[model samples]
Target: LIADEYIKMSDGTYPVLFVANKGRNVLLGREAVMRKEKMQTNQIVKDDELFERLRALRRKLAQEQGVPPFVVFSDETLREMSGKVPLT
Candidate 1:
């Protein structure tokens, strides 16, 4: 899939892909340029304050439920949540 559409100075020099399930088209190369720009600037991607708050919440919930923090929510899930910051 990459080799077919790969292009330098246009679609980005590196590949950053995420294939969705249910045969959905994810616009494979669309974000490549944006990601490349971010990578070049050494961007701080994660929202540290929100992430820490989520971790603290996870810890509290875990303690209350008598299970590990990961059992409540994985770190990756928290990171995604912090990145998106969904209101609902």
Candidate 2:
């Protein structure tokens, strides 16, 4: 289970939790966001073409380096790069 701020302490401790915006007092609990039997996947493609290209490049670099895909760079990192670096 995972949670953020505003979670009731009575809910018990979770193996993993990430609390953000604590200063502003934002809280969330795993059960509040998800069901135990259900799994949620993010399939929404905000930028499908660009994201696919970046994923392919990341996979190629990882194979060449003989490391895991994330070792080359995380998807989040690549997305950030896309925003910071303009295509030339």
Candidate with top TM-score is 1
Report the lDDT tens digits of candidate 1 across residue range 1-88. Answer: 4443332223467755644331133355434332334345433536899999999999999999999999999987888788887668
Model 2: lDDT of residue 9: 37
7-36 in candidate 2: lDDT tens per residue?
A: 223335654434444412433433334336
What is the overall TM-score of model 1 with all chains considered together? 0.47
The alpha-carbon root-mean-square deviation between model 1 and the true structure, to one decimal in Å, is 13.2
Weakest lDDT window of 10 consecutive positions for candidate 1: 18-27
Q: Which parts of model 2 have CA positions greater than 4 angstroms off?
A: 1-46, 85-88
Which residue ranges in model 1 land beyond 4 Å of their true spot? 1-44
Which pairs of residues have clashing backbones in candidate 1?
A: none
